[model samples]
Target: MAFTLGSLVLLCGISGLLTGVWSATIVPVKGNNCPKGWTQLDCYCYIYEDERRTFADAENVCNILGGNLVSIHSDLENALVLELSEAGGVAPGGGIWIGLTDAVSEDDFMWTDGSNVDFTNFSGGEAGDDDGDCVAMVTDTGEWVDDICAIPLPYVCIRETFRH
Candidate 1:
């Protein structure tokens, strides 16, 4: 196992390449490439569907459209979603299903998009057991509340902006 100069150089080069690869940060590209009828915010595109459907059904629809139910991670994002739903003609007092749920473990909510639950807009005493596992945003105030998954409601969907 004698080390040769060429072999040592090659090993060092490979190690350096791996280090560069591992340390690279993926910065999302912000562009105006969202699909038609979808609104772009940051790196994501969002859309609201006024059709009333149960949580599962709404999620299915979103999946069919190449996304998942919207996941709000900040107040600005939450307000944008609320605005999108309202502009799309959500009935007053009606709710719109979001992607948060604790179905796997009650009270431990997670977003279906696999994004971190870094923010929430729940109303007072929400994420409680008074309702079921699903979460819905009350159109009146854009506040979230737990609700039964079987309840039909409008929904918002989101996906990363695509480059065309």
Candidate 2:
């Protein structure tokens, strides 16, 4: 009985040591607090809520948080934007501005990141020309439209972590 008791204690100590080592080495450490009104997606954080600001101001805010204005390039991204707009409880009359415009010229809509607009998800034909250079999202219609980027419109910002 004495020998058994000693062995049990030894085994317990070993198990505790192993658990500590595993926890210390296997678990990844999370650093810093996430940006305000943002949620983590994978290793990056995102804010899907609509914010009222000019295009330049929106870009500045996103850059301060190490990100850029939301740029939709795929159907999945477009669907996500729709979901966020609905969830934000924005009034039916309000529209969300996206990070797309042909302000550089006409009929040459591009993202603020300087990427070519490969996907044109506009509802009313191609954007630009005839008072349509900026892009805004209409939740009621689920389409993008060209508008004036200088206008103070609600916009979406995207923040991605820099992996080094």
Candidate 3:
């Protein structure tokens, strides 16, 4: 019996298939580990923009990238976002627009994606501000702060890996 290169390759392939040794490619998940220029923590992708923009404009940019301003779900997620913002040189009290807003109803904060509110990181007496309707993350405390949606400020964008 002669074993040619092709035959060996075929046999190996078959063996792998039979033994289930071959697996599908594991594409990177956004929330788990984001791609270049994006940070991933669980299954969401986060991108921080150092340049300031109005809350609406920032959210538009995120939309162009197929994501929305970050909608935090847990403290861990909020912490990760805070870290990303800090790494980008966003100082404490520095504002970064997130997907949170109460534009729909005063004091009725909601994520831009229409996701129901699950968790919040509001600073002491933050959402109480009467002049603001949009939410931004304060790098100093990783707490939620309401600001005027039209005010330009650095912001973070978030999207699900499945969207991309």
Candidate 4:
């Protein structure tokens, strides 16, 4: 949707007389904007790295690829990522690192992307330990596990789908 400063000013100018009735065009973004080798989902792109790497190393790799570790916000997104990773044959007990971490404070997880963490899917007895600071998702259930940051594991990365 196109926004004009004049329109906003006019709306503000009329706020005293009006009772909150206004309208604006809502624009829809096109899909298929993710980079090659990344899967487009909503406005974000995701990729599952099969190679084992420490949480820090995985984050660095993601940074080099123009993104950070994936931060899941919904069940649908979690399921989608798990499906994609399972396509590469990750076993049930095997896990893939995500962006959640509590390295600074035990049991206080935060996303690397710096977005609001409104959703979480920690498994039973998980994310409660001080030693397990980093997070990984079990490929079979898409549930979370709190593991040490130094443990090597596969990981996922996500970034906004670029627009032309």
User: Best candidate per lDDT, number?
Assistant: 1
Question: How do the residues 106-129 of candidate 1 rate in per-residue lDDT, one tens digit apiece?
Answer: 888999988898898888845656
Sort by lDDT, top down from the best = 1, 4, 3, 2
User: What is the C-alpha lDDT profile of model 4 across 1-164, one tens digit per residue?
Assistant: 23786677567657734856445443558556888889988889999899999999999999999999999999999998898789867888799999999888776778998987888998874565546889999887889988888999988899998978
Q: Candidate 3, after superposition: displacement of residue 117 in Å?
A: 0.7
Better of 1 and 3 by TM-score: 1
The 10 consecutive residues of candidate 2 with the worst lDDT sum are 19-28
* Candidate 4 similarity to native, TM-score: 0.78
Error of 3 at 128 (Å): 0.8
- For model 3, where is the 10-residue window of minimal lDDT? 23-32
Off by over 4 Å in 3: 1-33, 162-164
- Candidate 3 per-residue lDDT, tens place, 97-156, comes to 889988888988889888888898888844766589998887888888778888999888
TM-score for each candidate, following the candidate numbering = 0.78, 0.68, 0.76, 0.78
lDDT of 2 by residue, 40-148 (tens): 5555555764667887888888778677777777786777776677788866656787878777877766788666677767876655355756788888766887777
Candidate lDDT scores, in order, read 0.88, 0.71, 0.83, 0.86
**lDDT agreement of model 2 with the native:** 0.71
